[model samples]
Structures are given as structure tokens and as C-alpha cells.
Target: MRQVLFLTKIFLKNLFRQPSIVFSSIILPLVVLWSTWWVTADLPMTFELANAEQDVSSSMIDVHVVTGSLTAMAITAGLFGFIITNEYRKISDRLELVGYSPTTTGFAIFLSLFVTLSFSIVITVFLANFLAAPKDPLGLTLAIVLVSLIYVSLGNLVAIIIPKATEGTLILLIVAFIDLMVLTNPMGGGVYLESWTYYLPGFWPIQVALEASFLGNASVSTMVYPLIYFVLTVILILFVRNARARSTMSFLSGGN
Candidate 1:
């Protein structure tokens, strides 16, 4: 436990040392959220999703703004997860060489990200309430957090597999823009999303956020689906990381 704590402290210290990262993790979300809110403030529109199940749709346009902002926030969370894992890969190897367990190091790195994400969540929800308050703030917050967790796990897995920062970032940005900004964005053509979009990572979270914003509640299935997806993603990440490590070790030993 102490070893994990010590590593967590170091990770956080190093994380805050980078001004660009700090800006992205904190200021960037605010900028995106505010910009979204500004553009839609005058629209005063409502949307009923195709094949709708609920009457309380995104009516105020504020709900749309909130959902968009939350998407941006989730994207940033994922980016942070990718960066921390990528930047600290060398240090993680060194720690393992010094007798630190991989599990402990991994947990510490996640802990640092969780701390930063928690702060981002609070800031996002607080600002959204002032600009576009949800009908059920608590539920919206949960929905947002779930989305962020899913993306962060994804980001971590991508970093492990790709190992190239620029390429990984490009992939993340492409997915985020397509899934959240285009497909799930009620203000745009999201109402006509194809059935296949249901499988996208951003789908359920936006549904839940819309429910919370306009209806004051979300369905059991809506909430549970994201959790299930998160668990599956995490399992895949662990499996991939372990397989990669084993492959590296085998190659180092010349396939002996």
C-alpha cells in the first residue's frame, strides 16, 4: 500500500510539472464547453431522437450544449490517460527493475489520473449548472463520469498498443469527434444516427446525459450499459498489456 502511495505521489508531481498537460486537463475543457454553449445559446430548439422512447427529449438546447461539453471533457480525460501512460513508460520499466510490482505502479498511475479527472468532473458539472443546468445534476454527473472512465481506459489501452504519441492522439481525436461531436450531438444530425452507432463508445453516455438533463432520470439499461462496456474495455487492456510484455520478454531471450 505504501509503495503504491509513494508512486502515486511521484506521478502526480510529474504530471503537474508539465504546463501544457495541466492546461489541457483543466483549461481546455472549459474553453470547449464555453464555446459550445455560446454557439447554441440562441438556437432555442428541441430534438426528438429517431425511434424515440421518451417524450422528454433534448428540449432546451441547453441539454445539447451540456452533452457536447461533457463529451469534450471525456475526450480530455482519455487524452490525459494516454499521455501519462506513454510518458511514464520508461520510468515504469525502471521501477519494475527496482523491485516495484507492475500492479502497484499501474494503480498509482491510475490513481493520479483519477484525482485529476475528479477535479475536472467537478469543474465541468459546476459550470454546466450555471450555463445549462440539468434536471438531475447528480445523475448527469454520474453519466459524465462513466463516459470519462470508458474513454480513459480506452486511451490507456491505445497507448500500450500503439506506443506512438502522435498516432495515438490522432486516433483518439478522430474517434472522439466522430462519436461524440457528430453522432451523439443532438444539436446536429445525431437524431438520424444509424443503428450501428449504438455500438460506439459515446452512445449510451449521451443518452444518459440527455435523460438526466431533460427528464431528471435515466433508465437502468442506459446506466448499466456504460458500466458493462467499461469493464470489458479494462479487461481487454489488461490482456493486451500482459501479452505485449510476455512477447517482449520472449524476444529479449531470443525465443529460448
Candidate 2:
């Protein structure tokens, strides 16, 4: 327990030192926020006023863009988190040689995911808040956290399967872009309207974020996706880890 915490702490502290990590945590979200605003500048802004006699409504397109932008940004943050995880893997490898166990590695990886991805999400929240003035701050934050952590776990799973950091990141980036653009498209009612698009990465998270932030609409069912993805990620990492442990044992025993 103590060791897991310590490892997690180390990863958190080290995250800020990396320029790439810092860029993802700070500049990426800002850029996403800016681009979303730039592209959707023509859209209407209809927010409620404090006056009891009035309620405001705006272009649904505007709302959709704003929500979709944040969802895209969340996907970007997760990709960046994957890059950081690759770096952390070097440290984990060394630790594994010295007496580390699966629990420590698993916990540490999760902590790293939460910490690194959370940094970017925080930036997104602050920036998006100013632009969209999200109605439910708590819901927005929770949605962002869920999306980021879920993607972080995903990044770890990719590391296990591909092993080559650069190749894996590249593949994940392409997939994320496709998933965000096609599945989470703002215009809606197009190719992505298929039932399967709902199952894609970033789909539910985006819906959760959009509903919570813009429409001020939410449901328990929305959260089900992120939780399901997280569980799948855990299972994947364990399978990969167990396979690696077996290989290590075999090597130690002279492949006999």
C-alpha cells in the first residue's frame, strides 16, 4: 500500500517535469478551447439569466459543437496520457526487476493515469467554463475525470499489446481522431448515426459531457459506458501483465 502510494507520488511529481506532459496539460486544452470557439463563433449563445421571469435558448448546433469540442479534447488528453505512460513504463520495468509486484504496478499505473490525465482535464474544465459557462460544473468535472481515467487505462493496455511506444501512440492517435470526428460529430444524424457508433471510444463520455455542460441534461445510463470501459481496461492490463510475468519466469528458469 505504502509502496504503491509512493510510486504514484513519484509519477505525479515527475509528470510536470516533462515538456510534452506540460504541453498536453496546459496548451492542448487551451488550443482545443480556442479552436472550438473559433469554428463555432457564429453560433448563438443562449444561457439562462438570474431574472426569474426569463429562460434562454440558443442554436442547438452551437451547443453540440461546444460539447463535442470538449469531448475531442478529452480524447487528445488521453492520447497525451499514453505518451506519458510509455515513459513511466521504463520506470516500471526497472522496478519489476527489483521486487515489485502486480498490485504495485497496476496501482501505480492507474495513479499515473489519473494524475496525468486529470491535469489536462482540469485545464479543459477551466477553459471550457469561461467559453460555455457550463450549467453543471460538478457533472462536467466528473465526466471529464471519467473520460480521462478511462482513456489512461486504455493507453496502458495499448502499451501491453504493441510494446513499441511510438507505433502504439500513432495508432491510438489515428483511432482517437477517427472516433472523435466520426462518432462524436457535432452535426449529428449522419454516417455516425449508426447504432455501433455509440460503442466507440469517446462516444458516451462526449455525450455525458455535452449533456451535462450545455443542455443541463444528464442520466445515470450515460455513466455506464465509462465504467464499462474502465473494467475492460483492467482486464486487459492484467492479462498482459500475467503473460509477461510468465515469460519472465520462463527466462529465469532457462526456458525449460
Candidate 3:
């Protein structure tokens, strides 16, 4: 427990010392959220129907717009692929040589990064709600947190595989584009299959938020999928850390 706390402290200290990293992780999200709200402030709430006689209500339309905006911002900020990749490049060898177990080190790094993500999301949501006053404030807040966690996990996984910072940033940009342009589009012209969007990690949070805002409270079942995704991410990260440790030990033992 003490070791974990020590590692966590060390990770945070190192994280905050880097001005660019701190700005990107914390300030970037707020900027994106504010810009979105500003640009969309004049838009009126209206929804189209394919063949139905009735149009969706203004409340529903507003909800859809807000949820979509939040999801996009969350994905952009929470996807810290470049940040983690840079950290690994700068410190992976030093960490390995310092006698710190890879699993412990990875967990500490993840936890510290998660804190920054959480802070950014929460602050942005607070500002958005305070200014515009979301109809379903509680639901929007919950959705923001869930979406942030899901994308952060995805970003972390990307970092593990992408060796270069530029490559990782490009990968995250592509992912964010796919998520927003393809998966989250309700117009049905996205790249993903119609049914496959439901399986995507960010889908449910956006869905639940829109439902709650536009159509009263959302179903409780909406929470289940993101939780499962979160658990699966943690497990996968642990496995990756353990695997890396084993490979390192083998190389050292073989004198290579």
C-alpha cells in the first residue's frame, strides 16, 4: 500500500513538472468544450424524422446536441495517447532499471493520468452547465465521467502499442475522428455497421445522456456496458505490464 502511494506521488510530481503535458491534459479539454458551446449557442433545437408525421421535441433536440458535444470533447481530451507514449519514451528504461515492478509502475502512471482526465472533464462540465444550464444536469455529469474513463482507457492501450509520440497522436486523432464522424452519427451513413455502434465504448454514455435530457430519466441498464468496458481495460493493462516484465527479465537472464 505504501509502495503504491509512493509511486502515485512520484508519478503526479513528474506529471505536473512538465508544463506542456499539464496544459494538454488539463487545459485542452476546457478549450474544446468552451469553443463547442460558443459555436453552437445560436443553434435552435430541431430534429427531423425519416417518414414519421411528427417531429422530435425541442428538448430532445437540445439533449442530442449537448450529448454529442460532450462526447466529442471527452474523446478529444481523454484520449491521451500521445502523452503516455512520450512518457514511456522518456522514462521506460529508467523506470525498468530502478527496480520498480512494471505492473506497479503502470498502475501508478494510469492512476495519475486518470486524475488529470477526471479533473478536466469535471471542470468542463461544471462550466458548461453553469453557463448554459443543461436540462438534465445530473445525467449529463454522469455521462461525462463515464465517457472520460472509457476513452482514457482506450488511449492508454494505444500508447502501449504505438512506439512513437507522433504515431500515437495520429492514432488518437484517427480514433477520435472515427468515433465522432462514424460511430456516433445518428444519420446512419457512418463507417461502422448500424448495430456495431452499440458495442463501442463511448456509445452508451452519449445515448444515456441524450435520453435523460430529452426523454426524462434514462434506463439503469445504460450504465452496465461502460462499467464492463472499464473493468476489461484494467485487466488488459495489467496483462500488458506483466508481459513486459516477463520479457525484460528473460532478456536480462539471457545476458542480452
Candidate 4:
């Protein structure tokens, strides 16, 4: 336990040391979205989602815009998860050399992600609430944080499978673009409400956020689905990453 804690502390320090990541992942993305949201206050969009239809008002627009911003943040967090884990491959090997088991190191990596997501959800929700507080603050924030897990796990999966940074990021970008369309549907196509859309990880949180911020009448399914998806996704990614780590450790031991 102490070993895991020590490694997690070091991992966090390295993760936050990147100024560009801080700006790109957290600061710059939110700022641009908020600015656009401010400019479009008068031009509010009335979206007829799967469950609720938003009315045209500054508050309604704020909720819609902030929800979209949260989507962008989730995507960013996931990509950073990819970059951070990929960057640490060498250090992970060194830790193994020093007798830190794969399980210990793996927990540390996930602990860092948990910390990142917690801070991210808090700050972004605080900012969104400043524009207009959701009727159910607790539920909205929890849903946002929970949904981010999907992207984070996706990133970890990508890092394990794809060795090239360029390829991994491009893949995440394309996948996130599709998910964003499902969540926002700025085209007014209403295609997102189709049966196929509910299968998406983005759908659950987006639906829950819509209900919490606008109608305040989310179904039980909305609250439950994201939890199931997030847990399953995280569990699957951990097993895959750990298995890969063990394979790599074995190879390293053989070489020594």
C-alpha cells in the first residue's frame, strides 16, 4: 500500500509538470468554450434530446454550452491519459527493475487518474455553475465525472495497443468527434436519439446532465447506465494494462 502511494505521488508530480498539458487539457479548452457561450447567450438553441427539450433562455443556453464544454473536457482528459501513460513506459520499466510489482505500479497510475478526474470535475462544474447552477448540483457533477471514465479507459486501451503517439491521438480524436456529435448534435438532425445512440458511453451522462440541468426529471436508467459503463470500462482496461505490464516484466526479467 505504501509502495503504491509513493509511486502515485511521483506520477502525479510528473503529470502536472507539463505546462502545455495544463493549458491545453484544462485551461484553454474551457476558456474558448465559455467565451463562445457568452457570445451566444442571445442565440440560445432549443435542443430536443432523447428525454427533454431545452427552452430558449440564457440559463438554458448556459446549460447546453457548459454541457458541451464538459464533453470537450472529458475528451481532453482521455487523451491526456493516453499521453501520460505512454510517456511513462520507460519509467514503468525502471520501477519494475527496482522490484515494484506490476500491480503496485498499475494502481498508482489509476490513482493519478482518479485524482485528475476529481479535480477536473470540480473545477469545470464550479465554472459551469457560475454561468447557471444546475437544479441538481450533486447529480450533475457526479454524472460528468462518471462519464469521463469512459474516455480515460479508452485512452489507456489505445496506449496499450498503439505504440505511435501520432496514431493513438488521431484515433482518439476521431472517436471523440463521433461521440461529441452524438452528445451535442448541433446539426439538429435528432439522429442521436436513435436506438443506436443509447449504446454509446457519452449518451448516459449527456442524458443525465440534460435532465439535471433542464428538466430535472431523469429516468432511473440514466443514473444507472453510466455507472455500469464506467465500472466495466475501467475494469476491462485495468486487466488489459496489467496483463501487458506483466508480459513486459517477464521479457525484461529474461533479458537481465
lDDT of 3 by residue, 1-256 (tens): 5666787787778777887765676677666666655655443455432222344455433443465556555565545644664576447546766777777677777777777666677676776566546667787777777777777777777777665677777777777656654575442244433566777766677665655555556567776777788789878977876786677778878945
Q: Give candidate 2 misplaced runs (Cα > 4 Å).
A: 41-61
Worst 10 residues of 2 by lDDT: 47-56
Best by TM-score: 1
Per-prediction TM-score to the true structure, in the order listed: 0.90, 0.83, 0.82, 0.83
The per-candidate count of clashes, in order, stands at: 0, 0, 0, 0
CA RMSD for every model? 2.3, 5.1, 4.0, 3.3
* Model 4 stretches astray by more than 4 angstroms: 39-60, 183-190, 249-256
- Leading candidate by lDDT: 1
Residue pairs with backbone atoms closer than 3 Å in model 2 (clashes): none
The candidate, 1 or 4, that scores higher on lDDT is 1
Task: Please tell me which model should have the higher lDDT, number 3 or number 4.
Answer: 4
- Lowest summed lDDT window (length 10), candidate 1: 49-58
Q: What TM-score should be assigned to candidate 3?
A: 0.82
- The 0-to-1 C-alpha lDDT of every candidate, in the order given, reads 0.77, 0.67, 0.64, 0.70
Which 10 consecutive positions of candidate 3 have the poorest summed lDDT?
A: 47-56
Q: Residues 1-256, candidate 4, lDDT per residue (tens digit)?
A: 9999999999888777877766756675577457746765555455555655454233446655646655666677678778877887778768877878766776788788667666666667777666656776666776677667778777877877786899999988777767764434433246757788788777777777767766655667678888898788777776876787778777877944
